[model samples]
Target chain A: DAGVTQSPTHLIKTRGQQVTLRCSPKSGHDTVSWYQQALGQGPQFIFQYYEEEERQRGNFPDRFSGHQFPNYSSELNVNALLLGDSALYLCASNPTAFTYEQYFGPGTRLTVT
Target chain B: EDQVTQSPEALRLQEGESSSLNCSYTVSGLRGLFWYRQDPGKGPEFLFTLYSAGEEKEKERLKATLTKKESFLHITAPKPEDSATYLCAVRGTGGFKTIFGAGTRLFVKA
Candidate 1:
């Protein structure tokens, strides 16, 4: 009964660089969503993936994108990173699209230098 | 626009002190309100979920109650281990996105 898991506990990237963070949802979950938590602020929704397609997105710019594999794992890619991109990237998963209780993973800390 | 607002940016209390945190929300149609506890450098851990007005849920020393306009998380005899940021979120009907409030940071000193 493994819970949601994320890779690369921490990362450091320079401006104009690209980075990809990975996430494996809880065993029985099928929907994956990504969030960004800036310093001293709450987590903000980035986007959501289901059935290998992005279903809903937040106000984030086009530089942020995500994908969901068949196994329910997900990847969040950020391109042309800026200093403001430094934040904790969190992944949450729910059993279905309508489920309200989402299990979260220990997020990946991205440091944009 | 759907929005969630939490009060008291931060709070410090004695080990045995009791207090309550507030979360107020405005949305078109309420679906669920969620509570989560998050430590520094860690993701949020699910706490309780309230679906309708007057719904209440309890776990250990924490109790959550909901109403039409707001929710309250009551802490009883809190300990140092209870120190963490409590986040409140809301999901509205016809959407999967959960709008979160800037959490309330609690520090229980022993």
Candidate 2:
């Protein structure tokens, strides 16, 4: 089974612009989470989606939003992006029964110029 | 608030040398403690999960142990290929969020 897939492995956007990152969860997984990892730092949770609805969110600001399709694929959208938004955006999938067995995608590297 | 803190911001070891990374957490109630290994330019890979205090799990040269307040990832006889940043996270009770630590970077020189 495919572990997890993401689109546009790399992207660049100017400050104040908007960007969208995508992810397809692993097979048989119902929950998906997003994280932002700065260089030389661990990932920080952004939010989580389950059953096509946001189930939890982290300390991120209102500019960040997300959508999870019925198929469990997810998209992360950022509005009025800032230079601070530049980082590796990660997508992780987890099964309800196996909470700790999260599988992560390669991640989309977003660079805000 | 649930939080995880990993110690020894970075470590360098000769190949075959051993070391341990620490993760301490404070949560209302613990659901699971996780350890992940992340290579440069890649997302994290799952290493081990300790569900409760005194629980231990192993895979190859890596073993993870958990206590009520902290967890440890012990790498024995590490190799160059094992060099990576080790992250620790916690699953808390009554919440869907998983809090993560800053992580420890390990470099094993062959």
Candidate 3:
């Protein structure tokens, strides 16, 4: 009965570099979504994946991409990271895309230096 | 554009006091409104979800109520442990993307 789990509790990256963060969804969940939370701000939706296909995306640019495996795990990849990209990366999962009740992970602290 | 706005950027209350946080939202064809509690540097923890106006949900010392354009999270006899940033979010008929507000920071002092 493990909740959502994210890899690399913390990470550091240089400008223009690429970073990949991983997430394992809660058991019995089939859909996964990613969000970015800046300091003192609420999380902003990044994208969502269902059945190994990206179903929807937010206002993020092409630099932000994701992949969902058959096991329901997800990976968020940010390319050409900027200092502004420094934030808490959160992974959320639900039973389905329309479930609306999402369980979140502890989040990965990404610092783009 | 779908948007969510939470009021009183921050609030401070003494232990045993009661208060409420506000979340005003505007979305075309609303689907659901959600409340979450987030500790500093941590991801948000789901608190409650309201699907339609007049719907209410309660857990422990917290109660959440929803209206057509707004939602309220009422905390009763809050304690220091209740101190955290409360977030409001919504999902519309557009897609699975949930729009979030800036959040309200609550500090319950002992």
Candidate 4:
């Protein structure tokens, strides 16, 4: 069985540009969540998607958004990126909304220059 | 606000050393507590989940124990391969969002 997978393992963007990162959840999982991890820090929640709708969001600003396709794949979009936006983006999936256990992907490293 | 706090930003130990990492949390109602191990530049790998106080879970040489307000991840006879940043997180009964602590970086030297 395939585990969670993410696309574009690494990315470089200029300030004020936009970037899109993709994620495919682990097989048999339906709920997808995104997180941001800065260097030397634990991940911070970004948002969660279930049934193609965003269910919960963190304290991040509107510049960050995401989409979940029917196949349980997800995409995270960041607009007007700033240097602070540079971090590792992680995608996690669980079997259901009620399940707290999550499997995480390798993550996408975003570098905003 | 729900919060999670981990202690000892970093630790260094010799091989076969036994040590413990701490994670203290405060939330409305605890749904579950989680422990994860993360390698450099990689996403976190799930370790254990504790649902209630007094719950304990063991895997390999790592053991996790929970209390009303804190959790402990105890490593027994750790090796260099066990070195990584251990993260602690909590989910509340009110919502699906999980809060994570800053994590403790463990370095086991051979």
| All DockQ scores | 0.87, 0.80, 0.87, 0.86
Per-candidate TM-score against the hidden true structure? 0.99, 0.97, 0.98, 0.99
List residue ranges in candidate 1 displaced over 4 A.
Answer: none
Residue range B1-110, candidate 1, lDDT tens digits: 89999998999999999999999999889989999999999999999999999999999999999999999999999999999999999999857798999999999999
Clashing pairs in 2: none
Task: Give the per-residue lDDT of model 4 (tens digit) for A1-113.
Answer: 99999999999999999999999999999999999999988899999999999999999999999999999899999999999999999999998988998999999999999
lDDT by candidate, in order shown: 0.96, 0.91, 0.95, 0.96
Tell how far residue B79 is off in model 2, in angstroms: 1.0
Q: Tell me which of candidates 3 and 4 scores higher on DockQ.
A: 3
- Chain A TM-score of each candidate structure, as shown: 0.98, 0.96, 0.98, 0.99
Ordered from best to worst TM-score, the candidate numbers read 4, 1, 3, 2
lDDT of 3 at A14: 100
- For model 2, the superposed segments whose C-alpha errors exceed 4 Å read none
Tens-digit per-residue lDDT, B12-89, candidate 2: 999998889999899888888889999999999988878888899999999999888878899999989999999999
Runs off by more than 4 Å, candidate 3: none
What lDDT does model 1 reach?
0.96
Docking class of 2: medium
lDDT score at residue B7, model 4, on the 0-100 scale:
92
lDDT of 1 at A103: 94
lDDT of 1 by residue, A4-75 (tens): 999999999999999999999999899999999998899999999999999999999999988899999999
